[model samples]
Target: MELIIAAGIIGLALGAIGAVIALRTAKSGTIREADNKVKSAHAEAEQVVSEARRTAETLKKEALLEAKEEIIKNRQAAEADDKQRKIEIHNLENRVMQREESLDRRNDALDKREHQLSSQQGNLDRRSRELEDLYQRQTAELERISDLTREDAHKELLDTVRSEVTHEAAAIIRESEQQVRAESQKTAQEIISLAIQRCASDHTAEITVTSVHIPSDDLKGRIIGREGRNIRTFEQVSGVNLVIDDTPETVVLSSFDPVRRETARVALENLIADGRIHPARIEEMYQKAASLVEQRVQEAGEQAAFDCGIHELHPELVKTLGALRYRTSFGQNVLRHSIEVAELCAIMAEELKVDARLAKRAGLLHDLGKAIDHEIEGPHAVIGADLARRHGERPVIVHAIEAHHGDIEPNTVLDVLVQAADAISASRPGARRESAENYIKRLEKLEKIANGHEGVERTYAMQAGREVHVMVQPDKISDAASTVLAHDIARQIEEEMEYPGQVRVVVIRESRATDIAK
Candidate 1:
């Protein structure tokens, strides 16, 4: 019986161990399910956070888009405001213009009415005066025939005659003539003053030579060339005098024709730059220089014509006009003088109510004769007129050309204006040059005159001999005497010498009376 109990205990232990293993496996499966649930909850939380972030980003994007739209809308509104303002401004300007035009029209109408009223009033006054004169004449004729008392009749007749034949008739005639003359003189003064003031250009003398400063004296030998062959060839080709004088590093190119001188100058500068002094180079430069001078001349002529409001000149005329760039008359450049005269004539013609176009044309062509005067024999005016006539200038233009110098009768006011303007330009102060000798002579004459005056001790020519300052003996000459001496000197200068502008005479009386102690 004990052996059977041991076998029962072993069987119970094996069954108990198998039940514990089954229970442990079920608990492990439950823990795995809980872990899976926790993982699912974490995933859901992450998904919610991501959706919130996306919504926030989308909201921010929408806000930004609205902000941009607002900015654009504001900008568009501002642009619209500006556009509306501009339109309003334009409308206001138009209204202002319309108002001004209406005002101008009303003023014109009022002026017209006033002029008509004035004319009618003048006509009525004239008719009333004529009727009174006729009635007085009838009464005078009746009184002369019916004389009652001789003395009374005579007194009555004298009173009637005195009223009829008063000084008022002569006074009226004189007043009318004076008004006409004053009007004419006033108009003339206005025209002349306007012309002068408008064209008041500073005049300068002309020269045919240009001095080119060389880099050094060494450049001179190169220009002279080997045995002076280069210089000879240059002169032959350019027709300019190359004056290599004592002047160091400087050479003078002289020619009567400034164009030729300029051509030579440019060619020389080019040759010096190239440093190749040869006959071939000289020829090449000469040809180029000739072409350039021609071009410059053409440009000068075109510029002059444009500035003077003259257009459409013939090619030959243009070329000839350019030649004037080299020509000068009485210390004033011919080209510049022509332009000034043309402008002055235009101004005068306008003020005088004459043909401005014709005046300018005549003025411009006035000096055309000077271009060929060196080559021609007769007076420049006649020669220029002949040349213009050949070139198919109008008869009026030709006449003006001849008449500007007072050589012929000027039929048109254009001719007179040109003449007057030319005279004004030429006769202006400092327009021409006086020789040094002549200037010195004038100064000496002025000094001698001042010295000849009583109580005058010494004299000096001041202000380029324009003013004479006389130092008089103060002991002999009073202040009043100094003034008298000044006037006398001025009178002497005026009478004895023909000077430019005017000369001012000044008398200075300075005295020194000293007694040295012995």
Candidate 2:
């Protein structure tokens, strides 16, 4: 029994130990599974942090790129605006500069005018004092010499007034006649205006230089030639100057004579084409060119006469008319002006029922002397009259040409027509394109010359400086003094002023004596 009991205890201990071992084995397996779960969670957290960092880095890079683009855009916009402002400021400066220059010119003119006025005032005051002293002396002398009283003088003045009543009646009749003459004057104005309106002609201006273009700069040395002999020959033959400058394949020909200039142009063109430049070739080409120019001149003359319907002009007169093509007056073509004057004269003569053909002929040849005035002396009008006379023209026509400028005084209707036509042709708008400064200077000079004379109350330069009228005080100047003043003023104007045609001087004086009966 005891053995059995001990065996039983051992079996129990063995069973308990087996149970403990199984439990310990199951505990170990649980620890291993927990460790595996912890490791998986750590790895997942690391992966999430890495993905967030990558997203942050991409956002930072995008923001930087956007900032750089915005900066570049703003800079471009600011630069464009700045450029625009600068351009505006520069333009404004230019306009302001122009206005300042104009104002300066105006101020200078004002100063000059003020100085002239001050001088005139001083002269007038001194003259007035002298006249007052002279009048006082004259009055005293008369009072001392006369044996008559105031009552006798009054009675004599009444007698003189009674005797002047008949003359006053004639004056009233003259006033009535002037009132009736308005219709005739109106008709005359209509005719003149009609003549001006019907005439239309173009004016051409000529310069003293011509330019020749070459294909290359290599031709410049050839034109000058070796040792400059070719250039000298060209100058002597053509009577023109060869201006070889650094203007790049260009040569300028300068001459006072248009015919010679035209010849040189043609000849130079030929020589440049022929490529043979020498003294001998130059002379030969110049001769041919001159012949060509002569032929062109004749053709031009014939065309001019045909256009004017004037067929019977002398050949010499025709040639002179052609020469006028090269001449300019105040930037107006002389030949064209002559043609316009002729047309105007014919129109006016037709309206006035006069000889239109004779008027046209005289008008066309009126400025003939201008063609050779440089080679002759005396006035153009007088020289032209002599030319017409020598060319077998009618005496009346020659007189018309001379009298057109009033050098000989207009005696016939044709003379008056020529004068009127010439004035209209020259004074029209755009006919004489004189600069504004020159025009102002001419007017100022006219006033200056008139102010120089004594016994002049006031002076006015009228008709675009074509006439100057002087008014003299009656107390300071008598009628005879007025006539002398007119002559003196005219002579002074002739000596001092440079103008075209003629200027008429009119001096007017009026005396008034007023008495109140009351």
Candidate 3:
């Protein structure tokens, strides 16, 4: 057992020894692998550090190049800005120098002009003094030669001029009268004769009072109505006066307006015929009568226009013209008179070679104012002229209408023709009439007007007061003065009198010289 034990110990010892050797060998090999790995790691770390250094050097070089290029760009930009500023400053200096040169030239020109003006002023002052002295010397010389002061010579010259002008004016008046009479008298007579012959219209006598025949006297009370209601309503509505009198079945309707009278007449006649007279019935009848009259007025206007050969009249104008059917002037129907005047105007216009249509139109409408003269306050001629103008008549036609009555001066040939036609129509025999008393009064007035003038010995009113003959003493009135006297008397009559048509004044002067030697 001891021997086995010793052998086991020894084997153990050897195994231990081997195990130790193996352990030492494995440790040394691990040490060598560690050393190698350490060496490789150090090498790799050095290579990465070297590459990082190279990359940092390259970035540092690029940064230095960029900084240098930025400095060059800045310097070039500064140099270019400085060059542009210098160029602008040089141009400004050139402009200033040019302005100073132009100002110097203007100043020199102004100084030259001032010197010339001063020279001209001095010359004008010298000339003015010379002229004043010359004028004084001439005035003194003229006073010495005349042997009279300036005031006395002036008065004497004025007196001579006044006397000479008076005589010259009188001579001109006489000569113009002779020339006008010789030129116009025969032509005027012929035209007037032809117009009168061509137109032969009948005259109608219309009065303000229109008589309505009632069937019996009982109608008067019915027409008057209860408590005068019917008559009052009639007057208020128709604008007419209802006059009831004991004239045997005759009730008179009176109004200054012919239209009102005519309307009232028709209404009363209708009321009497219908036999229903009350305030209501009267009013109804009045309205119907008014409408009927209005229609008649329209028709009459149309007919008058047709007769006058004027178809272009406005509707309102036609209606107004028809109103003349009920109107009258000095006992003559105004419509008939107007138609006659139109015909006369047309005939005279044809003879004078003027506008016959225009003449006829003016004459037809010349008395248009008489249609409404009672409502309006003006001369009929002016009123008619305004009416014609408002209705689109030409200015010439309006002027002719206005001037036909001598309301304004007759400036045109048409105006004269209208005047002559109006006169001829009014003054023809039986064309217009007045009471005997008024006729005698007018004749006496005509003679009295002529006798009131100077240098008149006697007066005679001829042609039913159409003309006046005045005898003047030859010793008191000269030939030229007679013509002036005739004109003055005619003008005075026109201003003072309201006679129809025109008046003729003849101032007759006879000069006689007696010889007693045989």
Candidate 4:
């Protein structure tokens, strides 16, 4: 039994060993399968990772391109904005510069005005000091020299000044009418009145436009030929406007210059009278008209001088004097005015014991400059004076002519007499028509100019702006100051005014003391 049992145990151990080997083989197969699966998964994961890397690279490139494009666009926009800002800044700078320049000009003007005011103030102060010193000396001398009190001397001085001024002014008037009142009161006026009545002239004033009467309106078409050439040629030759319109039986001639108007009128009238209207014919007629007008002017000039009982004037001067016939001053015929003034001057010179013949000659030639004033510049008086001097006139007559309007100071009685006669002629009631607004403005300006001075208390413009009366505060203005003030005012008026006549500036300084018996 022991042999059999040992054999069975050996068989059992063999079986056990076999079973262990089988188990090991199955576990090895499972591990191999797991390894193969894990390797395949690793390969798949590698492929996925490679594709993802390619996609990431492509995306990165696209993003980089977009970012670059964005950077470029931002840069361009920033550059454009910078350029616009620069332009605006430049414009603002220019505007600022212009404003600064304007302010600088204004400042310069202000500085100049201040300088002028300061200079005037300095002159006024110096004058005041000098006047004060003179007054002190005069007061001391008066007190030492006279037994009369200051009030008595002051009254006597005022009386003496009044009497002297009145006497000198009245005596200068040469009241011939007053002197001849007993025998022939109208003798002095009769001379001028008779001259006016003797010399009969057409009172019709020449107009800028003159009417040309034609035979019929059909003639207008001939006057204005094909393409308006005839009219153009006529105007070119005549130097005037020819108006061809619906007006019946007439044509019009227009020009601003009176002499030109007169010439054109005569030219047109001759063309009408001849009835041969063409450019060549118009030219011929115009020349003839000019010659005719010149002859007429010469006749008128010679007759004017002869009628005034004056002779020996320059031939050119006589012609110019004759030209005044076409000139009108304030609706009074300049030629007529001149003749009247000459006659009046002759009478006044006879009364004043002056050169009557010289006075009449000067008066006739006084307005000679007016003939050519339209062609020249400057005052008529100054121009006439120059003409007279150029034509070898006497120095006294030349001076009298120049000083007739107070352009120069009157140095002789003849000068004064001429001035008076000119004033009388120019200032007749209907001689001039001053616009009311102009008159008021002139009066206001005269007052304003006088009031511009220091120490003036009140200012009055009187005698239709011929005189300025300034009343100064006695305490502020001295006797010498009054005189200087008058002179200054007169000078300022002359510098600024366009008045036809001289202005008399009178400054009054009154000092009155009163003791009431209350």
lDDT of the candidates, in the order given: 0.80, 0.82, 0.86, 0.78
Tens digit of lDDT per residue, candidate 1, span 1-518?
A: 33444455455445544544454456775756655555554565556556555666777788899999999999999999999999999999999999999999999999999999999999999999999999888777766788454567788889777655444544554567589888797887787777778887876687767798888899888888899988899999998899887798899998877678878988998888888889999999889988988899999989988888888777777777888887887678888888888898888878767888888888888988888786788898999899888888889988988998878888888788778878877767667676789778878988988888778888999877778888888887766555556767778777787655457777787766799898
Best by TM-score: 3
Q: State in Å the error of residue 453, model 4.
A: 12
Top model number, lDDT:
3
User: Cα-based RMSD of the predictions, in order?
Assistant: 29.9, 33.1, 16.2, 27.3
Cα deviation at 98, candidate 3, in Å, is 36
TM-score for each model: 0.51, 0.54, 0.62, 0.49
lDDT of 2 by residue, 1-518 (tens): 33444455556555555554554566665755655544554565456556555666777789899999999999999999999999999999999999999999999999999999999999999999999999988877776788665577789889788546635654564566478777587887788778878777778766667889999999999999999999999998888999999999899998767777888999999999999999999999999989988887777778878888888778888887788777777888888888889999999999889989888888888988887786798888999999889989999999998998879988889999999899889877678777789878988888788778777888888987888888888887765556666767788888887676578888878877899998
1-518: candidate 4 lDDT, tens digit per residue: 33444455455555555544555566765756656655555565556556555666777789899999999999999999999999999999999999999999999999999999999999999999999999988987878888676889889999889767655544543354246675664764665455445433444445447788888888899889878988998889878898988889988888655566677789877777788888889889889888888888889889999899888889988888878877777656788778877876777777668898988887877887788787889888889999989999999889988888778998987787677677667765456565699889999999999999999999999988889899999987766556667777988998998776568898999988989897
Total colliding residue pairs, candidate 3: 0
Positional deviation of residue 408's Cα in model 2 after best superposition, in angstroms: 2.7
Candidate 1 overall lDDT versus native: 0.80
Candidate 3 lands at a TM-score of 0.62
Off by over 4 Å in 3: 1-178, 406-410, 435-441, 471-487, 506-518
For model 3, what is the error of residue 222's alpha carbon versus the real structure, in angstroms, after optimal superposition? 2.9
Clash totals, every prediction: 0, 0, 0, 0
